[model samples]
Each structure stands twice: as structure tokens, then as C-alpha cells.
Target: MKNNIWLDGLRSVRRMGETAVVAAKAGIKYAIEKPSNARLMRETFEDLGSTYIKLGQFIASTPSLFPREFVEEFQGCLDQTPKLPFSYIQEVLESEFAGRDLGDIFASIDEIPLASASIAQVHAATLVTGEDVVIKVQKPGVETILYTDLNVLHWSTKLLEKAVPKVKFASLADIVEEIKTRMVREVDFIEEAKNIDDFVNYLNITHNKAATAPKVYHQYSTRRILTMQRLHGVSLTDFEVVKKFTKDPSQVLITAMNTWFGSLMMCESFHADLHAGNLMLLDDGRVGFIDFGIVGQLNPEVWTASIAFMDALQKTDFPLMAENMLKMGMTDQKIDTKILAQDLERLFTGVLSADPQQILSSNPADLNDIMMDMVGVGERHGIRFPRDFALLFKQMLYFDRFMRILAPYTDIYADQRLQMIQTMDPNILLKH
Candidate 1:
């Protein structure tokens, strides 16, 4: 314990020194460049790398937790980074494999990365057994850096909370804790592998043929290295490119949505980050859901409340919506259901006037505006949504955007194919 404490102390000192240097550089840049505060903060986070980049993304997605301007600016905080040298990647592979010769394992591992992100870089490789696969290699010292940065953030948030007791936003320390939990899970390839397996198993049990996830090669996978079957496809974002692959692009998206909806009621967790880049139309005509690094699991109460909210929205039941909104969110004080229902009626009467089924707008700006309005309403009612609810709501917005591009006429709420909450089987997704 003494040795561990000494080592932790050294790491903390080093981290503090590094943070000071970064802050100084950022301060100097601010003095010289005169950039907006949000932009400057985003740039500083980018320079800080890994943890800060992830934090910026967390801010971008959780609009309920941050100011609108910061959230809008941080949307440009892309997770992409300059690729680490091939030598560094090879070093990671070698160290991870330890005693085993890499040549004995991988027949050929491409030096060029398929994708490079904050946590890991992916490369196309072939197994000695003659199967094409992709290897996701964790950057060196990612876990150590992650923990160190999180520790620093945790301390800072605690200080901030004590310093300013009446902050308008949700608890900063709680947000940091959530980020720490998420980033820790993200760096763990074993957990990610299991997420993929669980999702695949869900697909099989449902006998769904239109959607699939990569097959994990367990023998080649580790906590730092994940090897999975290589998928050949174009991202669902490119409508024209998607057209070249399938005649009905809308059907493809619908299939993906159906599978995803089923997972909400069937699998252990749902793919929380279903951005266009992470979803693909595979060569085999199946929707490929990639990147299990970020997944969300909802407790039965939350899920049930969410479903109730959705059902109320679809049916235009403002009172029921108000009741479910209260159920879905956290609040200390008693709320009047009737007044809240009246407020919700006014909000939804304006929003749902055009289309009763359209719960979310297709335009990103419009969606963000609507979310801000909803957050305003929640605040007035002394309610704050759970982070998981925000995640689930954001993905639904993503699907709404995709629908506008691929299937403008289709009504997702009314579609027979969509496994709506009303149709879901009990005793699933939630562990009894």
C-alpha cells in the first residue's frame, strides 16, 4: 500500500505539471488569438488529448448538462487525431502478445490504420488460419492517462462544486464520475468484445437476417487488442453510395432501426453511439453496427418510463406524457401533474401540430432547439433526466435525421415493422 501510494503521488505530480503547461499554452494562445471562450476551451481539450477529447464529446452529446453555446461549439470537437507512428502501434501489439511471436498469429497486419481515434486505432489484418479480420489496438498508456486525467477532473469538479454551490447545471462531480465509468469501459476491449457477442446473440435469437455485428475472434482478442471479422461496406451516411449497394436505402435504415429497437427490449445493452459513421450498409445487404466501445443499459424502471413517454407522445396523450416525464426524470419536490400536463400540452401542441407521429425534428439545429426547449421545461418542473436517457434520446434523433434523408414519407411510430414499446415483450433487456 505504501509503494502504491508513492507511485500514485508521483503520477499525480506529473499530471499536475503537464496540466499546468497545457493551461499556460492555452492562456498564451487566448491572449494572442482572441478566439471565443468555447473555441479556446475546445482547442485546449484537443491539445490535452484522450480524456479531454472524450469529455468534449460527452459535453456535445449531453445538452441537458452543459450550456447551449459550449455544447454547440464542442460539436466540432471531432474525436479524430493524428495517427501514432506504425512503430508505436507495433510496440503495443508486441507487448500485448508478450511471449507469442506476432508472425505466428497474424499472417499480415497492415501498417496503415483503417481508423484512428482517441482510444484506439484499427488496422486490417489476416489471421494465420486465413481469415480476414480487423485489429483494434489500444494506444500505449491510454488506461494510465485515462485514470490520471479522470482523477484530476474529479478533484477539480469537487473543488468547483464547493466553490460554487448554486450552479444551474447537474452536479459536476457526478458528471465526471459518469465520464470516468464510460471511458474505463471504452478502453477495455474484453468488455467491448462481450458487448458485440451479446448483441450478436440477440440477433440470432430474434432470427434477424437484415442486421449484424462483427464476429469477435476471442483467441486473438485481449483487453488491449480486439480482433474481429472485417466488414466490407459503405457508411449509411452517404445516400448516393448507399444507393449503389441497395435499391431501397430506406428499407436498409428501417432494418437497422428495427434491429436496434429490438435490442432495447432483447439485448443486455444498446449501441448508444449509432452515428452514421458507426453504422454501415454491408456488402451482404445487412446493416453493420460497429464500435461497441459505447453502449447504454437502462434499468427496467427507466425503460418502462421511457416507453410510456414514447407511447404517450405517439398517442398525443399530454397528461400521460406529463406523468411519464415525471417518472423518467429525477426530482426531489412534488410536481403537480395537471399544470405539468398543461405545459407539456402547449409544448407538444406546437411541435406535434404538423405531424402527430414526429416526436423529433430531422434538422440537427432544430433538434437541438427542441432539446433546449425540453430542458427548459424540465428545469421549470424541477426535473433532470438521467444520462442514459439523454443517450437514448440522442440516438433517436440520429435515426430521425436518417429517416429524412432515406425515407421522408415513412412514419417510424406507425410503421408495422418497428417494434414499438407497446409491442415489446416483457422480461427482456432488463435483468430480472
Candidate 2:
């Protein structure tokens, strides 16, 4: 951890000077009539290595919080790390299992990693007794580096906020801060193990047979390392493969949706990052969820408000919607709630009536327009949603995208989706 911290500090100090130099060079190229500024910026980050690649992934994930142009561009950001030599792998394994010999534990270990990410490399291995597993080896000093890297992100976000008041409503700094905390939590493998356990227990309790996360090998894992059941199959993004795997991709989607939604009540926390890359189509034809590092938990009160908010939306009750948003994201200012409710009611009513399905569409309507209108209501009502509200909204937007990919015509609030929402014990909602 100490070494990681130092490396992170070194990276922050090093990047400042390099970014400035690159910015100057890019500016010069732009002055000479070229399209190299943004290109150079992107290239520079790529050249800066793994940490930058991870940051690029972060930007790609938070589309609602960033410029669409930059977010879209970073979707192609590459992330491949240098594979350590066999000698280094040996040393790391020995350090992990000091007195024990590898031969006694794993019957065989793959020299090649199945996937490599910014902080760790995952290699497939099998236990001596014939159990298959994958070991996730953390790149040394990753934690410390991330700490320093996040500080720099915070600083940059602060600069952006200070320079642009119009964009303050977006709160880039707060978003980065939230991400930093999540990332920091993710780098700790011990925490991840616990998260894995929670979800596993959740699956068992819910009796969800359609999906399962990998089982963790607690004895072989630690803060910097993890060993778990090796999960293999096609990624959800492979449409051709998906079609080959199942005739009813729509059915698979129902399973995924129900599993995730049920977790909000069945599990101790919810998996906040269930992106395609983190999900897999297992050999048994079940969805395999991985990476439980980032999660979300709503207060009981907020949960109640959430149900009410969605109920009102289902009925197109904008006055109730406005009231719920106000109460959920309580503010310290005064405004005419009655008038604000009436105006927002009129606005949502228009959209709800025009295309209630728009709530689940991906045709790229201008959210900026809807957001501006909501902001206008906020301005009038003195209703400033807390950062958490923004985060939750962003999550819903991700779900919207996910649904578009799987089943475009299915309405999440429709009777078809109720099988998922209704499986929960309704009594859980009355908790204090």
C-alpha cells in the first residue's frame, strides 16, 4: 500500500508537466490548421499508460456527466497491460503462498491471462483436486497510484467547475469525488470478496437460477489478490454469439432484469456497475455477473420515495413526481412547491402523453431539453437534487440503455416487468 501510494504520487507529478507540454504541442498543431488537438490529447493519455486508460474507462461510463463527444470518443480507449515475466509471476505466487508449493494447490496454471485490466491481470488456473479457478493478481503499487490519480482528477474537476458556472449544475467535482471513492474501494480485493459473498447469498435466497456470480476462494485471496471460480463464455455485446446461444435473448433479458431488480430488496446492496463487460453468457446458459466492487444502497425513506416516484410516473402524475423529487432530494431553500408542481406536471404530462415509451428509448432524444426544463422547475421551486439523486438518475439512464440493447419494446413499468418487481416481500418496504 505504501509503495502504491508513492507510485500514484509520482504519476500525478509526472502527468502535470507532460499534460502541459502536450497541450502546448497540440495547440501549435491546431494553429497550423490540423485536427490533431483532440487526437493528440487522446494519444497522449494512451501513451501515459494504464492509469490513463482506467480514467478513460471512467469517462466512458459516466456519459450523462460528460460531453457526449468526449464520452463517445473514449468508448474506443484501449486497455492492455504489460504481462509480467514468468519469473515475476513465480515470485508473486511464492510471496502469496510462501511455504506452499504451487504444484500442491493448482493442478495446472495458465501462463497467459484471460483478460488484463489497468490494475490486475486474471489468469485461469485449476486446483490440484480438479477445481477450476482464476487468480486475479493486482499490479503492485496500483492502489497508491490510484489514490494519487484520483486526487489529480478531483483537481481537474475543480478547475472545470471554477471556470464555468453555467456547468455547475452538473457538479463534475462531486461526480469525480464519488467515482474516486468507488474506484478506491474497488482496488481493495478483500472488499470485493465480501461483495461477492453478499451477491452469492442474495442469489441463493432469491432462488434466482438464471444467473450467478463467480464463487470466491477466500483462503487464496487477499487485499491485493483474488481467486475465484473461472467464468467463461461470450460477452453480452456479441450479438451473433448471443443469437447462437439462445433463441430467446428476450427471455434472457427478463432473467437479468429480474435478478438485478430483486437484489435491491433481497441483497444487502445493489450492483451499480452491471455493464456488458461485467456480464457473461456462461456455458450452462446462465448469465454470469462479475466485479461487485461498486454498489449502491438507498435509505429506507429514499426507497419508499423511489417506489412512489415510479408509481406516479406510471400514472403520469407529475404533481406527485415533483413532490417526490422534492422530498427525496430535500433542499434548504424556499420555493412555491404548489406552482412548481403544477408547471412540472404540465411538462412531464406532455412527454408522458407524447411517448411514455420514451422513458425506455435509445433514439437519442435531447435529454438536455428535458433536463433544462427540470432545472427550470428546480430554479422556480428552489429544489436542488443532491448529488446522490444525480447518481441515481444516471444509473437509470444506464438501465435505459441496457434495456434498449436487450428488448427495445418492453416497458419496464409494464405488467410484463411486474413479475420481477413483485417477487420481493412487500413487507421489506415498511422498514425504519
Candidate 3:
């Protein structure tokens, strides 16, 4: 035990040193090239590997929590990682399914990966019974690297707090701890499988035929290896391809949004990451939802308040919005509702009045800037939102982007087809 602990300590130190060297080299190159700070930081995170890549992706997703510059620049932090050799993948499968022959379970697995990310690589495979599936295999030693990097990050956050006491108010350490917890859960395929199962159940119970998630094969899935039904679809970002799948892409977006909203009240947890890549237009015309690694769950109180908040926003009731925001967030002292309403009105008037064409053509960074400004206002008014709210808000922004492409002239809030608040059943809330 002692030797193992010593070895882990050595590994952490070595990893930290290696990361520092890489950062130093990148910094020197940036000094010579005079690149923007955000670009340099994104490059540095990419070079640092998995944990930082995940962090970069988080920053890219959560615009309300990050500065627009950082959020916009980190959007280039693509989740593609170099593919590991198939031999390593086979070894992991063998270890995960000990005493079982690979040929008995899978008839064939393509050597080339379908997609490779920092922590895992996915391969298209055929089961012995002839079902097509995708095998998501964890990269060798990724957990070790993740833990090392996360520890280094935790240490750095502590140092930052010590160096600057005011930074503690932001709860940097707590934030890092929360991130670590989620990242750790993400590496567990078993947990991810459970998340998908719950989501599928939610869809069934709600009679949502318009959306579907992958079906996990538990016999073939383990902690490091996830075997699931291979979805045939084009990403929502592929506008032309999506049009081929469904003639009315706007209905697709509405279905996706309604299904997602229903999951908030009905499912054990909601899909926390709904970026364009994870949402798809299936060949069957149903919206295919994939990647159940990240999910969010709100407490009953917060969930109720969030529902109220959405309703208030849609109704353009500033007072109700302020009241719901206060309910949804943390505030030690009472805030003047009148002041908050005035601020919200001032903040949203321009957004509400923006031309549809201009909004459709607007840069996502501009939208993020507006949302972050609203967050800044809330902060000044003594409201601090939970991270779960940020995750949901990010998905809403993604849905907005989809609408801009699929239905440029339509106002999502006023669209009769968008049954956002009406879809939430009071019975479902009671069950929770």
C-alpha cells in the first residue's frame, strides 16, 4: 500500500512537471508568434491532454459562467484525440470481459476507430447475433492521467485561494471538486449505461416517440467498455444532411426541445450535454440522443423554481421572473424585487427587440455575451445560480442555435409548436 502511494505521488509530480514543460514551450512560442491569450490557452489545454481538454469543452459549453472571449475561443477545442492502436483496445476488452473470448461476443470490430476522444475511442462492431453496435473503449491509463491532472488542478485552486482571499467567494475549490466528481463519473461506463437506461425509461413513460437514446447491452458493457446500439444519423449541425432526414428541421428542433424538457421532470437525471454533436436527426426521422456520460439533476425546490422561471420568461413577466430567479438561486440577504425587475427589463428589452434576421446571423459569442451580462446582473443583485442551471442554460443556447439554422424567421418563444412549459406534467413533478 505504502509503495503504491509513493508511486502515485511520483507519477503526479512527473505529470505536473511534464505539463509545465509543455506549457513553457507553448508560452515561448506564443511570445514569438504574438497569438491571442485565449488561443494560446486553448492550445496549451489541448497539449495538456484529457482533463484539460474536458475543461476546455466545459468552458466552451457554459457561456453563462465564462467570459465570451474564452468561451468563443475554446469552441475550437475539438473533442478529437489521436486513436490508440487496436491492440490496446483489444487488451482492454479482454481485461474487461475476462474468461470470455472476443470472437464469441463480437464477430468483428473495425480496426479504425469511428471516433476517438481524449478518454475513449469508439469502434463500429458487429455482435455475434448480427446486431451492429458501437464499442466505446477507455484508453489505457486514462484514469491515472485524469486523476493526476485533477489533483494538480485541485492543488492549484487551493493555491489561488491562499494567494487571493477574495477568490474564495467564488468557491473555486468547491467548483473544482464538483468538476472532479463529474469527470470521475464520466469515466465509468456502467454509470453512463444506467443514465441512458433511465433516460429511455423517461421517454417511454412520457410517450415520446420523436426522440430516442441508444440501448446499452449490459452483458457487453463494463466500467471501461460501453457497448451500445449504433445510431445511424447525421449531426444537427449538418443542416443539409438533416434536411435530407426530415423535410421540416424546425419540427425536429421542437421535438428535441420538448423531449429534453420532459426529461427534466420525469427522468432520474437530464441530459446535461446536448451540443450539436450529441443531438442528431436519425435516418428514421426520430431525434437520436447519444452520449449519456454527463447528466444533471436539480433538487425538487430548484426544479420547481426553474420551471416557474421558464414560464415567467416566456410570459415576459419581469416580476415573476425575478421572484423565480431568487427562488432558483442562492441568496443570503433579501434583494429588492423592483430593482431586479428593472434590471431584467433593461437587459432583455434589446434582446427581445432584436430583428429576427440579425439574430439568425448573429455570432454565438454575441448571444453568450448577452446571457453572461444577465448573469452579471443577477450576481450584482445577490443571486448565485447552481452549476446545473448553467448546464441547462447551455443546452438552451444550443437549441437556439439550431433554431437559427432550421427556422430562421420563427420566434421559438412564441412558436405554437414549442410546447416548452405546457409539456411539463404536474403529476410528473409530484412523482419526484
Candidate 4:
């Protein structure tokens, strides 16, 4: 125990030293180049590497917990990092499949990666049995670096909160904890493999043919290495490519939306990061859901209230919306339901009047504004939504972006095919 403590102390000192050097270099650059604080911090985060990049993304996505300027600025924090050498990737593969002949396992692995990101690099490969697959290889020392960086951030945030009691938000430490949990999960391929299996199982159970996720080859997968069936497709965002694949792209959107909405109730977790890249229109005329690194789950109570909230949204029933909102959030203060209902009515009225499409616009500025407005209204009513709400709303915004290209005129709420409440219960719509 004594030796372990000593080693841990030594590791902490080394990490602190490394962090200080990096920060000092960034500080010098900031001093020399007069950039906005937000921009400078973003650059510094990039310089600091993977953990910081993920944190920046968290900030960009969670507008409720961050300032507008910072959130907007961090949107530039793309996760595209320099790809590690192929030799390094091969080393990882060899270590992961130690004692096994790699040549027997993989017939061929393209040295040139299909994609590279902060946490992992994906390469197209073929199994010995001639099945085309993609290998997602985790970078070396990523988990160690993640733990080191998050520990530093967590400790610093706690210190700052105590030193400055008037800190902007009391949840800084909580935010760090949240980031750590998510980042750790992201680096675990086993967890991600299970996420894919669960989602694929949902597809099979529903007997859905329109959309699917890649099949996980669990026998060939590990915590650091994920092997899965490779899918050939064009991203849903590429309007022209998607058009070539499907004559009725709008129907494709509906199918994807319905599949996802059903997952909220039928599946253990819903895909949280369904951005343009992660969602695709396959060459086979099916919607492809990729990348199971991030997922969100809603409890039965939260989901029921959420369904009611959506029904209320469609009907414009302000009182029911307010009640559902209250059910989906938490607060210590007494909330006046009538006042909250009035606030929702006013907010929604103003939003719709400002151009109804803007309500569903996936433009970053527009989404941020809508989120801020909703969060502001909730704050006024002493209601703070759970993280699941944010995840759900962000995905809805992404779907809106797809709608603009595929089904601009379709009213998502009124569309008969949008199995919003029907997925949960057929009688739900009538009752609502």
C-alpha cells in the first residue's frame, strides 16, 4: 500500500509538470496572439489532446451548462486528430490478439485508415473467411492519459469552486465527473460492442427492414479492438448521394426517425450521436446507424412523461406540457404550474411566429438559442431538466436538419407515419 501510494504520488507530480509545460506554452501563444479567451482556450484544449477535445465537445453540446460565447466557440473543436502511424495500430492489434496469428485472423487490413478521431482510428479490413469488416483500434495510452487529464481537471475545478465561491455555476465538478464517465465509456470497445448488439437486437425484434446497425463480431473484439461488419453508404447529409440511393428520401427519414423513436421505449439505450456522419443511407436502400460509442437511456417514468410532453407539444396543450415538464425535471423550490404553462405558451408562440421551421433548424446558432430559451424558461420555473433531455433535444435538432433537405414541408408533429406515441401505446394518442 505504501509503495502504491508513493508511485501514485510520483505519477501525479509528473502529470502536473507535463500539464504546466503545455499550459505555459499555450499561455505564451495567447499573450503573443490577441485572440478571444474562448478561442485561446479552445486552441489550448486541442494542444492538450484527447480528453480536452472531448471536454470541448461536451461544452459545445451542453449549452445549458455553459456560457453562450464559450459554447459557440467550442463548436469549432472538431474531433479529427492526426492519425497515429500504421505501425502503432498494428502493435495494438497484435497486443490485443496476443498469442493468435494476426494473418489468420485478418486477411487484410488497409494501412490507410477509413477515419481517425481522438479516441480511435478505423480501418477497413477483411476477415480470414472473406467478410469485409472495419477494425476500430484504440490509441495507445489513451486510458491512462484520460485518467490523468480528468483527474487534473476535476481537482482544478474543485479548487476553483472553493477559491471563488461566486463561481458561475456550482456544477463544475459535476460536469467533470460526467465527462469522465462518458470518456471512459467511449474508450471501452466492449461496452460499445454491447451497445451495438443491443441496438441490432432491437432491429431484429421489431422486424424492421428499413434501418440497421453494423453487426459486432464479438469473438474478434476486445476492450481496445472492435471488429464489425463494414457498411458501404453515403451520409444522410449528402443530399445528392442520398437521392441517388432512395427515390423518396423523406420516407427514408421517416423510417429512420420511427426506428430511433421506437428504440427509446423498446431498446435499452438510444443512439445519442446521430449526426449526419453517423447516420447514412446505405447502398442497399437501408438507413445505417453507426458508431455506438455514445448512447442515452431514459427511465420508464421519464419516457412516459416525455411521450406526454411530445403529445402536448403537437396539440399545443400548454398545461399538459407544463405538467410533463415538471415531471421530467427536478427542483427544490415550489413551482407555480399555471405560471409555467403561461411561460411555455408564450415561448412556443413566439418561436412559431418567428418562422415555424426555425423551431426545427439544425443551425448551431438557432439550436443554441432555442435551447437557451427553453433552459431560461425552466430556470425561471425552478425546473432543471435531466441530461437525457438534452441528449433527446440535440438528436431532434439533428433530425430537423435532415428534414430541411429531405422533407422540408412535412410537419413532423402532424405526420401520421411518425410513430411518436404509437410506438409506446396505440391508445396513447387518443388519450392525449
TM-scores for all predictions: 0.88, 0.72, 0.86, 0.88
What does the lDDT read for residue 157 in candidate 3? 84
Model 2 is weakest, by summed lDDT over 10 consecutive residues, at 360-369
TM-score of 2: 0.72
List, residue by residue over 1-432, the lDDT tens digit for candidate 2: 697567567866776666567657667767785764335556656765566677676665554455545555665676667787555665667767878888988888898888777788888999887888998887755665566666666887777777886773376767777777777777888988988898888788656788999999898887887889988788876655887898777666667767776776666677876656677888889989887867777565665676677777777777778778766756666656678668877777765445434543322233334544555566666665543344455555445455555666767567365453444554444212
lDDT string, candidate 3, 1-432, tens digits: 697578667777888898889878997988799888788889989989998999898777665566667888987787788889999998889978889999999999999999999989999999999999999999976787899899889888888788998752377776688778889999999999999999898887777888999999999999999999999989886777888777788999999998887777677888887767788888888999999999999676776787687667768899998888888756777899999988998887777676644554323455566667777887788776677887776567667757876888887867888765445555564346
Please report, as a residue range, the 10-residue window in candidate 3 with the lowest summed lDDT.
Answer: 356-365
Deviation in angstroms for 362 in model 3? 12
**lDDT tens digits by residue: candidate 1, 165-220:** 89765477777878888889999999999999999998886678888899999988
Ten residues in sequence with the least summed lDDT for candidate 4: 423-432
In model 2, state the lDDT of residue 325: 76
> Model 4, 1-432: lDDT tens per residue?
697567666766776788899889988987898888888889889888888999999888887788778888998898899989999999989978989999999999999998999999999999999999999999876766788899889888989999999988788888888888988999999999999988887788767898999999999999999999999989876777788787788888888889988888777788888877788888888999999899888776776787788778768899999888878756667789899999999887765555545554334666767777788898887777777787787677667556765777787767888876444444322212
Which residue runs does candidate 1 get wrong by more than 4 Å? 1-15, 28-37, 315-317, 336-366, 422-430
